[model samples]
Target chain A: MEQWRFIDFGLVDIRDMMAMDEAILKGDGDNTFFFWTPKKSIILGFFQKAEVELDLSKCKDYTITRRISGGGIAFSDDRCRQINYGVVGTIDNDLFPLDIIESYKQVCGVLIDTLVHYGLNAAFRPINDVTVDNKKISGNAQTRWEGKLLQNGTLLLDFDIEEMLRIANIPKEKFLDKKIASIREGLTWLDRELGEQRDMEEVRNVMKKKFEERFHVRLKTGTLSSNEKELTKNFLPKYYSPEWVYR
Target chain B: MEILKTKPGIHKARGGLIRSFVFVENGILKDITISGDFFLFPEEAIFKILENLKGTPVKREELLKNIEDTYAKEKIQSPGTAPSDFTESIMKALEA
Candidate 1:
């Protein structure tokens, strides 16, 4: 069987996490499956305007930045135990299909499998969301650079709805078709779904296993290569700059 | 005849919600800013569409055709949002 590198980058600053994603996509590295938790922050979709998506007055303490992928806004915090995972590899491989929607389905399928293993009825909602009973538990997005594809996602172990509402300016139009009246009514987390918090390491293990099974590859624990580290270092300033974040 | 005004419009298409802020002056599109949670391949295509709409007459059919033309030229692939969705939001902004 083929082997893919797997790295668990425990906890990283949100900006550094964004930088690393771009670095891995741009650098020549082995196909990688990485896990990490980001420090408190609100990550904007590539196309989103921060001023329109965020209530800046309430986000003074958060690290705000825009990711390379196009999706909705995402809020992550290590304290809340939000877990993140990414799969990065060259487009030449069959692991990720060339069609955007098809690839999203394939990547999000892994999350659905992992959730099913936990006895939850998780389903892949088109575009890029994993939902349990129609409530979103995870959101994912992807970006392609040259020949490489980087798809990253967040799995909410627990969500602070009040905190999220305070910082995010989720427009009411987004919920027009859905029965969702508020963010709380439209979201579910592992902790709330299971009635308890699952061990973080245990959850990561399941993710690693599901990814391997779905893609038919072995995940070998590994770390970032020298090239990836250097690229990440070079890319840090862009994430830290207000020009990119507010753009 | 510089009567500049900006208005916000929001619409939920089959694929996702598209929100737009349209700036108009003297019944002509001055500029437009489109942002949303929807996924658009070659994310920069939105800007191209905005540029194409500038100076367009503030009419539903014209706005719709310009947006459609940009999508065709750019080969825009927004899974959940269609050109009509964008036109709807932009038209809504103008009407507002």
Candidate 2:
């Protein structure tokens, strides 16, 4: 069986979470699932130019940066409301399918099943998303670096709609164009769906069991090695730098 | 010569939104940057799309044909929007 290390991290800087993934991909770490409820923050896609996607003034209230992978911009506020997930491993990982689309489908498939277990009618949306009633509850991004693949996404246990809007969901910038209400239309939250907030730990435990079953792997509790910790420190500056985030 | 700028158009396709911005000089696409909330596999493929458009005549049909041919040969998969959708955005920019 493919043995995947599972690490549940406490709230950390979003950049450190991203940097740890990079450190893992570089072989300083193992194939693992890194879980963290990030501090209130916004991390843009690698290719996303902040000017077009985010409002600068709004970002001052949050920790803003970018990830190495590409996808839509994401934000998180309270830890209780968001559970961020990352799948980090080499391309040879048995958990990942060979085809890019299939890889996305596989990961999102497990996500759908996991959400379904929560009594949420979740379905996998093509490319990289999970939805309920056609509204996204999870959005994902992936990167294949040489022989390594790292897929990171968010799970919205609960999301503050107003906070999301005030932060400039570009398409939902109502002040600029109320008619372009696509973001809100497409997004949803677990709390909103269930009409009650479930304990975050209870949801996380269930999710861990679901992941273990989906990949047919044993998830042993694991954390950063000293080497990986040092590497994350080295990688932090890039994620924090304006040049890299703006690039 | 005046620097040309295409008004950004956000096309909501199946997969997601594909936003297009076109820059033209003398009826040729001097530069173009297509970005969006859309997901593009390989991510780097985006730069290649932008690169292929460089120096191309800024005609709707021509730009559409270029991207369509490239997307087909490259086996490009954009879930929501099609290559034609991209050309349509460029066409709007051309009109403006």
Task: Single out the weakest 10-residue window by summed lDDT for candidate 1 chain B.
Answer: B1-10
Alpha-carbon lDDT, every model: 0.84, 0.75
Evaluate every candidate with DockQ and list the scores. Answer: 0.56, 0.32
lDDT of 1 by residue, A1-247 (tens): 9999988887788899889888888888978988888888888998888877787988999989998888888897546588798889777546788887788888888889999999999998887889999999999988887877889999999888888888887778787577777767889999999999899889988988899999899999887889999999999999999999987
lDDT of 2 by residue, B1-96 (tens): 121234665565555555667777898988776656665555667777778988899887888888877786676666556777777767766665
Candidate 1, RMSD to the unseen true structure: 2.4
Q: For candidate 2, give the lDDT of residue B20.
A: 65
Candidate 1: regions farther than 4 A off: A92-94, B1-6
List each model's interface RMSD: 2.4, 3.8
Model 1: which residue pairs collide?
A: B15-B80
Please identify model 2 stretches exceeding 4 Å from their true place.
A92-94, A172-182, B1-6, B65-85
lDDT of 2 by residue, A1-247 (tens): 7788999987888888788878877666777887888898888886566766776778787888888776788888764578788887666535686666678777777678878987888887777888887788998988877677788888898887787677664653221222434656667888888889889888888788888888888899988888988888899899888888865
RMSD of 2: 3.8
